[model samples]
Target chain A: MMSLRLQLGIIFIMLVVAGSIVHFLRRKSIDFRYALAWLFVDVVIIILAIFPRAMVWLSQILGVASPVNMVLFVGLCLSLVVIFSLSMSVSRLADKVRKLSQEIAIIRKDVFDGDNRVREEMNNIKD
Target chain B: MKKLVIIPAFNEEGNLEKTILDIKENAPAFDYVIINDCSTDGTLAMCRRHGFSYLNLPVNLGIGGAVQTGYRYAYYHGYDIAVQFDGDGQHSASYLPEMAERLEETGSDMVIGSRFITKEGFQSSSLRRLGIRYFTFLIRLLTGKKITDPTSGMRMINRKLMEKFTEEYPKDYPEPESVVTVLSEKHRVTEMPVIMNEREEGSSSISLGNGVYYMVKVSFAMVIARMKR
Candidate 1:
């Protein structure tokens, strides 16, 4: 059984996270796709806070020594997944930025030269 | 056939003028573009003053990114062949036409300007030569293709390979790894004998301290690249 103080602490953390997610969503700062992962994490935390016995039961089933250990293990795994996803996204963004910069350089040249021949030829080739 | 030479320069202000002049005087038939890799020097100023044909990268993309930019330009501009020539005055423009011709004659997708093939002209430091030899043996062990000068920056690629390179290219210290990539992709890579001069000004980007790191990193990349298939 979780102590009242521990339960309250978890509740406080859930509220803070939920508030931040709401604020981010309202401001449209993060995409819904990315926010969905955070929302899922929030839901898991809330569920664990409400039913502390679930963690105990999971801990017993997983042969872990304590519910706290189970919680830490799950948290570490989830953090890994989150970090891995973030790294993948960062890699993709880097590639996109690189491509954008290359295109910008080429387009800037075309614009400055007052000749659309290269641009036109590129578009025709793409077509 | 329209050929484009890519001169990737980074803070090579001292040599850029003479290099450009040499290309204009010797390899005038081939169109050239200087990729100024966000040099923190008078290189860009020189380009603007001379009104030289160049693509100025807003950010420092390193040598790989700079060369890939040139390849991308060649692809977009519909050049039949693209040659990568260094801006440090090390690569000879006189040999460029012959390199392009070798690419066409042998029906090879790429032609490398090799110094070791002739065992002559600026073979680099002995330690660097050892690293090159190690990579040569490693590449031979992995793939049947043997590259005498895998680290040579002077290379020419046909349009087909240029299209591929524009899409994807190695990031840093890319010369040797790119050679491995081309070979693994079943592309024909041949080498032509050429004499490379020592850099006229500025030090090489690969310093003595980082030489070991470079060798290890590039060798690791070469092995990992082979495992992809």
Candidate 2:
């Protein structure tokens, strides 16, 4: 049978692995421009997963006590989830902004060209 | 008054001759500059045949770029008034004097040929009509001015406005957005009642997907315009 300490570590590792997997899958549809942000988020998760003690220290500084271990573990897990969610939101927003800019650039180019192709395409879209 | 008409022509081979000839016959006093947007058709040939002043762009630039080029020419050459003429034949030259007179009387920097100023026939697609309505709402909200036809290319601007418009003109379907531009610059923009004829030849380039794209793009631009000091 695994010791309590090893069991806790295994659970932590599993949780981190599952989260990373889900995050990777979820973010796969995002644009390549957001790769750096997602990568940084993944790196933070990896660091937090490897050093559970760091989380304990953080909890202590935040005034978490009485069932210190439990509180720290839950706190760390919640913090990681929030961070991941925020990173995903930011990545998505970045993609939206980039798409907007590119569309503007193409339209801007078309205006000067006088090809009327863009206008025709827009008319067709309206129909 | 020495007036120069700036006509932005893009793939307008079909209507170029007639439009130019009409302008020549009606407003012969007004010298014209047709900005050829690297037309693949016989648009340039028509300009040459009519002996109209023209500038051929190396590559096709949309209405915004072509119009801005005209403005730049107007600013540099010292044109008293610059009128934006559409090569698509939607605008009539007969209304030029009336539109110009309105601008002169009001001391307005820009004068727009508004179809809604009177009962004018608008032949645009229904979706475009809705888009124009939305744009009209947006402009009124932003500029505190009730602009009926925000996308009319038949407009006139004086030397002062020509200088400013030449400096920075909106690219990509600029007509609707230009009201915001002129308003933000604290320039007076007035609209005149004028009827527009339907585009006679060549299909418009705007598509549904492109329309959605245009909406988002212009919305973002409006936000930026609002944020400007």
Candidate 3:
């Protein structure tokens, strides 16, 4: 069983995490889709912290040696999922950056060249 | 109908000017856009000095990205046809009209300027020729369409395929893999014989060390593209 002091410490950490997530959402620093994953992780942590016995029961059902080991395993798995999802998003962003850079180059040429052509035509008319 | 020629260049500082001038003199009707793929040379300076219609890519987006940029530009500009012309001065602008004519006559989605159709012009090195033949056989095996010059950089695509290419295109050694993409879509791809000149300047991008890797990688990309469709 987790001590009351340890439970209070976990609650404090959860509050800090939830607050940070809220701050990030309010500031629109992170997209909602990504924040949703982090928020889900915080909720799971809070639930596990609130009912330590639930984790102990889960460990017993899963044949884990201890509740602590179960918690570590779950944390590691969730972290892997989050990291994997982040890597996928990074890959997509890289592709978008490539396309955007290419489009910008093309548009820059169109606009600047148009301006140059008009200036040349004006000079030609003056001449 | 508006036709645009996309010349993708990488470190072709010496040859680029001549290539553009040749196009301007020979094929005055067709509009051309030079996609300067962040060359580590004076290519950009040359473009600016000549007031050439060129797109200076901020990053080095290989040949595939460079050509796709041209296609995207063509698509947005409402061009009816877009041709992928090389910046190295090997591709003659004189052949543009004939290729365009063939594209219209056959109503093909894409027309590739082939060096082997007439068995004339500067055929690539013997090893490169062997590799080309191997890919030709591989493409024929998968798509049942024979592409004699799968590695040729000179190609013309109609608006339909141009729109598709704008959405997604192969990245590395994209020529052969792109052929597979078009064939998988059941679009018509044909070849027109055109004479190619020796490179006016600059070294070829595919060196001997990477030749084998290029062949294997492109073959794998083609196979995977076929499977995905």
TM-score of chain B of each: 0.98, 0.94, 0.98
lDDT of each model, Cα atoms only? 0.88, 0.74, 0.90
TM-score of 1: 0.91
- State the lDDT of candidate 1 residue by residue for B68-157, as single tens digits: 999999999999999999989898899988888899899999999999988888989998888889989999988888999999999999
lDDT of 2 by residue, A1-127 (tens): 2245754675576567556656766879554444445555445554544565665676567765533354446646666765787798886665454334433433443454465667788899999
Ranking by DockQ: 3, 1, 2
Best by DockQ: 3
Q: What's the TM for chain B in candidate 3?
A: 0.98
Output the better candidate (2/3) by DockQ. 3
Q: How high is the DockQ of candidate 3? A: 0.65
For every candidate in turn, the CA RMSD to the true structure comes to 4.8, 12.0, 3.7
* Candidate 3 or 2, higher lDDT: 3
TM-score of chain B of 1: 0.98
Candidate 1 local lDDT, residue A54: 93
State the RMSD for candidate 3. Answer: 3.7
Which clashing pairs does model 1 show?
A: none
How does each model score on TM-score? Answer: 0.91, 0.64, 0.80
